[model samples]
Target: MKTLSLFIAVCIASTCYSQLKKLPIKKTADLHAFFHYTGKGERIISGHRGSYLKGYPENAIETFAYVLKNTPAFFEIDPRLTKDSVIVLLHDATLDRTTTGKGKLSDYTWEEVKQLRLKDRDGNITPYRIPTLQEAIDWARGKTVLNLDKKDVPMQMIADLLRKNKADHFMMVTVHNAKQAKFYFNDNPERMMSAFVKTEDALKEYEAAGIPWKNMIAYIGSENKPANKVMFDLLHARGVMCMISAAPVYDKLATVQERAAAYRDIFAQGADILESDLPVEVAEAMKQKH
Candidate 1:
């Protein structure tokens, strides 16, 4: 009986790992092709902070895996620098909120950071620890795409890390403006970017910067508004996918029905991608639309 139980456990674990959805992008060209808008109403989902599931701490590899097991999606994660200049996946500048540790994250070395356990959104401590940026890039190779949100880490450092890992295919950086986008573009013209093209002016800036539209997915904004239509028409014409983040807006809806309706509305309005804190929930909500 003991031998049978151990065999069952191993089989279950293998099945779970095998069930994960993967984005099999092999190079920068493939990544760009994946994000290109075809205007067939294809909707992509991205997990904000990896996901906001109970007991699965945000930005942890476990949380990312949990989402992939349920549905196909990418992740938008934060990268911050430690005292020793190591890059780690963490949203806040301080560790007090998401981890068992206190004080600013920059004060701790990676060794000290590794000793702390991660906490879920509800503040329940979990077995997962802080993951380094390198670990994330390595793990996401063929699993899914990772969009690295801008934090305290320098652009030079991020570029160096991506080069070291050869992760340009599966990794993307979020740039707030054309200047930041140009920095990455000049470094590697093939690098993919999640750019903030929330306004016509912002869109013009990227156009003026001369960064190829093939290398980007534009983030329109958090809400689905009438104004977004103009941006959508513009970007889609250029074969760029536009993303609407529901992390701040729709995910906060008081009930599941309301949130589901909002999620459906985002796609119906022609947004190609939806970034959310509740990616699993968004996936379920989107099912009813089809």
Candidate 2:
């Protein structure tokens, strides 16, 4: 019985290690080139909320690490602050939905939040606990890029964390408009930032920001497929890559094949990045012929 138990333990440990594995991205250069429009039409994928499937809890380190290990994709995670002013990965203002805790996320101290287990998208409680921003940043070092969506934390705090971890190049912050992009660019000129450019006016706005185009990724929102070829061309002219988020349109499709075609269409429209909830599926689709 003792030997059997030891064998079981070993198997479990191996499985856990397999789940937390890293990808083949040896350095940040490959990821940087893919996002910065320098990779010669390399199509990139941003795993929405870190592939929050059945076993993978959203915004959890395990999910992010698993995606990094399995797929050639970066991830987007939401950052919130605790009552004690600690930055943590959480989507909503309250933890009642994603965690076992009650009330506002800010109501709990970091210690209290750490005790709460994360829930999968289907609402099943997982064994993972909330990870601090610094913990996530540390784990992403030289492995994968992270798009840090500014949810509840201040921009300055986020910038400081990126600088402290020396993760500016590997991580990104999403900016809604050119003004916000300018603000973040002014604060830390070297950091990577993503902004939306839906029209010619939007392009003008970004150009007016006075920041270098190399440091930004333009998110061109599309319907079922990528539109606005002129905007894409304009951005590419200035050495900027545009991302098309397929989550809003293609995620609701009934089959993977349909979604795959949609992704291919987006790329055909000159989108450099593909954002999706099904990162693994999309990455697989990208490899296959449309």
Candidate 3:
């Protein structure tokens, strides 16, 4: 009996370690360096909404872990405020779609929110509960990066959360424009951002704001186009990596083969990173190239 128990414990520990792919980032500079463009065809995969799988719920820590188990990828998560002012990982203002609970997320306090279980994309209820942003941050430290997308939460509050946890090394914020980027930059000079620079005018806006290019990775657009080549060249010249989000476009394709082809084409067209809802599939598609 004793030998069996010891064997089970060892297996559990090994399984946990194998599931996590560590980023090895300990400081802000390390995070920046990881995202810096090197012109060596470095392709990265980012999980959009934590890579919602059949059994895993979107924006749940469990889903994030499942993706990391299959591939080395970071996550783009949404943060929203509760009625009692606690920050939580949720993609929508309403909980009906992603949780067992109904009504607005802000209508419930953290205590009430924690009681509800998460639902997968197919509406199948899972045992996983909603995770606090702080809980997710704690889990991501040294394990993976969490890119917080702009939601209903105020920018100052998000910045304060980062300051409170001292999580500048692994946390990144999504900024829609130069002003938002500048705000985070001024708060912490080492802060890394995923900025929207899909156009030449937007590129000029960041240049005018005077934020260092080393501090950002530009999101060129949803689809790969002839125009993206121009932005890729321009941003790559500044040592900033370029990303393309396929969540809106190719992830909705009719078949797995079609999505896989789209994933391959994105990198073939000069995108440094591809953000997708099916990160595991994306990893599988690009396995040979990497």
Q: Which stretches of candidate 3 lie over 4 Å from their true place?
A: 2-15
lDDT string, candidate 1, 165-250, tens digits? 88898999999999999999999999999999999999999999999999999998998998889999999999999999999888
Worst 10 contiguous positions by lDDT, candidate 2? 19-28
Over 4 Å off in model 2, which ranges?
1-32
Candidate 3 on 1-290: residue-level lDDT in tens?
99999988986644475558777688887998899999988989999999887899999888888888888899999999999999999998999999999999999999999999999989999988999999999888888999999999999999999999999899999999999999999998889999999999999999999999999999988988878899999999999999999999899999988999899999999999999999999999997553
User: lDDT for model 3, on a 0 to 1 scale?
Assistant: 0.92
lDDT of each: 0.92, 0.79, 0.92
RMSD of each: 1.8, 3.1, 2.0
Encode model 2's per-residue lDDT on 131-229: one tens digit a residue.
Answer: 988888887776677898868888888878777876776788988888888878887777678777788888888778786787778888856343567
Name the lDDT value of residue 79 in candidate 1: 97
User: What is the Å distance of residue 77 in model 1 from its true position?
Assistant: 0.3
Residue range with the least summed lDDT across 10 consecutive positions in model 1:
10-19
